[model samples]
Target: MNQDFVNNLYDIKGKVAIVTGATGALGKAAAWGFAYAGAKVMLTARTQSKLEALYDEMKAQGLECAYQIGDPIIESDVDHVVAATVKEFGGVDILLCAAGMNNPKPILEQPTEEWEAIMDANIKGTWLYCKKVGQVLKEQARGGKVILVSSTRGKLGMKNYTAYSPSKAAIDLMAKSLACEWGEYGINVNAIGPTVFRSDLTEWMFTDDTARTKFLTRIPIGRLGEPEDYVGVCNFLASSASNFITGTTIYVDGGYLAG
Candidate 1:
């Protein structure tokens, strides 16, 4: 292609990124990566302390960042985050929906409330954020990038991940459908399906010897994933490098799905 396109493909300087679930390990890693890439980042989560601490750390590193504390599952909170981002940074160039919950239960034993909770946080929350923030991108006439954090469970059937898997599966399809509808406006929608990673949510799995061994045995790569392992891919999908790419889910599973 053009030399200019190649040169600027991954250049995200001056862009504004909004990362939900900033309090979580994966989310924080994404936020920091964007900030380090010279993008002004807006962090969002339900915990004020964590958000503030992360924002402070980024600022200390001389990275441009701000934060808002709120629950992603709440519509008003989503609206406030978008509005605040617009007010402070003009508009958002990228959106990273990383807020999600997982409750492992066999299909037959899964509680109705737990199932609803997973769907609400993972599926509906993602849709709502895309709907509201996507409008701003469309109106501004600047194509934007949206990356939804899904899981390998979405691509493969897992035994006890009934609730979590389906919600993530919906997210993968949702990204595709949104890409189809929004492509004309220059908006790209994609997802990242990650395998086991060291995070607060998965600490319990690591603590159990049998569970850890079982999980590692499934990965052909012979190792588990870390949050940093996904940073590069997240950056690519959010930057100009992925301008022509959309409606797909990129697996960062380290061969977990291969076997």
Candidate 2:
């Protein structure tokens, strides 16, 4: 391939990326990945200390980045984050909604409030960010990327994922619906569904135990995922390389979904 073609592929330099759930494991991975790839990143989350800490860490690396405090479920908070990103970075070219929660419990044991909380965090939060950030991309009239986080649970049913599974399933559809709705505006909306990644929530899966051993049997690759495994995929989705790809969940599950 020519140099121009090679350079254009996966090129995200100078683009502005807003990463929600900036304090979470995937959030940190995406934020740093984008920044390291030369995109100006705006980190947003509900916790100020964590936001500042992340911002500081990135700043120390000499990466162009800023932070905003916001809750994905709150409209005003989402609005401020969008506004703050534009103010800090001039304009947003990508959005990675990594803000989500999961409280796995049996259907009979799950409370209404807890279920609603999961919905609010995973579903509503994703919708709110897409709605607000989409407006900006529409106005700019520049094609943009929207990366929503889903899980393998979104497609496969798990015993105790009463609320979490449905919430993620909704996200998969939301990405498709938004992709169709915003295609006219040149905005690409897609979801990334990972299977049992190493994170604060899935840390126990890394231990040598029956649960870990049992789970490994399901993965064809015979391994758990790590935060680093996400960097390339996130970069692909955020960069111009994926301009024509949308409305689908790219499963980063080490062939678990293939089985």
Candidate 3:
């Protein structure tokens, strides 16, 4: 193998990527990163207006991108998004399962509906998207990449993280199982576990002094993560550089998990 080729393996030119929850802050950042790396990106979310906005923004930036509005929790919607992507882009090469929700509450106080919402949105949604995209990759007989966005809460326990924690934990494990089943089919499944990224979701946490201090104390880097912090890892995972890597979770948590 040529060393030069291996080093340049991170190039994702000409690949097609489908990103769920593209309307959200983190999701949009991930989609932009993929487009920046030369991949044709398909953004999916429940809100058509938001998706269209993002699509137009990316296009204005001279990026190859499209959008599909649908709920990932519905199998039909998932199928529709996959079909649309295939019809428009020819085939799928990468998937970013960034759709998820978080409702902070103590286990004892967490409502049943809250837990159900988190599980359905995070675990089931991610699984369905991967399943539909994985089938496309299998049919094409071409290996591809699947990247699940998880959290440090999945790896460690924390107060008021009841619903969110278990859902992300499921995501991390699902990536491993998917990798085991799809590696022979040329698919790579992995996850990125981030901690306290600056996003709309974390706005409340940052505003609360106690919450911010508690969250920051665990991180060795003593700072919160920015959306750009995850771009490099996302690019690496979606590229050939990670061809032989699967069934693992890379923490982009600013050393939060090290403690």
Candidate 4:
């Protein structure tokens, strides 16, 4: 095949992407990655201030992006986000569920409320958005992409991660189930699993602490993951390049799971 033909497979210009948790580290990276790649991005988050700030920042960079304030776990809020995206961008071609939370604590010390919160945010929120967007995609019948964020925790057990790990595990399975269910419509559902990426949640690991050193040894690459490391994978999954791929978790860790 010609090289330009191969390159054009990744093109996503004019595609409309709805990104939840648009203010978070990985979410921000994904949103900017899509916007800069010529796709129009609609960002959704709970806080208007943070969402507006991110929107302004992207606007300054001449990126095409908009914001919608909605709590990911709320069903009605999710409905509104889908409706808003249709109104703003005319239609949706991609959905990125990036809103998630983690509360690391020993099993006994993990409060019921904390576990519920993590489940609600990471699992329920992702499912709700996927459900609504899946409807839209099916109706359009043009095939689309659904990208869910997972983590290595989904596959690997860790201390003080009882609640968080299970939540991510559910996300991974959800992606597979959705992929299989939507394959007939040409919708691709996949998850991106990252190992200890730089984010507000992982700020503690970035400091001069022993945990950082211990974690570093587990990763064969010998360093932590930065948000920028995610741009390529996001672009690939959100574009035609990933048309044949679905029902999989593409791990973007620095070879952490390899070892």
Query: Which has the better lDDT: candidate 3, or candidate 4?
Result: 4
Clashing pairs in model 3?
Answer: 143-186
TM-score versus the correct structure, for each prediction: 0.96, 0.98, 0.95, 0.97
Candidate 3 global CA lDDT score: 0.90
Once fitted onto the true fold, the runs of candidate 4 whose alpha carbons sit more than 4 angstroms away are: none
Q: Which 10 residues in a row give candidate 3 its minimum summed lDDT?
A: 198-207
Q: Report model 1's TM-score to 2 decimal places.
A: 0.96
Candidate 2 steric clashes: 0
- Deviation in Å, model 2, residue 33 alpha carbon: 0.4
Per-residue lDDT tens digits of candidate 1, residues 1-259? 8899889988899999999998887898899889998999999998888888898889999999888887888889999999999999999999999998888888899889989999999998899899999999999998999999999989888789888888999999999999999999999999999998889877888789888888888788887788899899989998878988999999999898888
Give me the overall lDDT of model 2: 0.93
- For every candidate, C-alpha RMSD to the true structure in Å: 1.4, 1.0, 1.5, 1.0
Candidate 4 residue-wise lDDT, 54-88, digit = tens: 99999999988888899999899999989999999
Ranking by TM-score: 2, 4, 1, 3
| Distance from true location, Cα of 238 in model 3, Å | 0.4
Candidate 2, 130-189: lDDT as tens digits:
999999999999889999999999999999998998899999999999999998988999
- Say which candidate scores most in lDDT: 4
Which of the two, 1 or 4, has more lDDT?
4
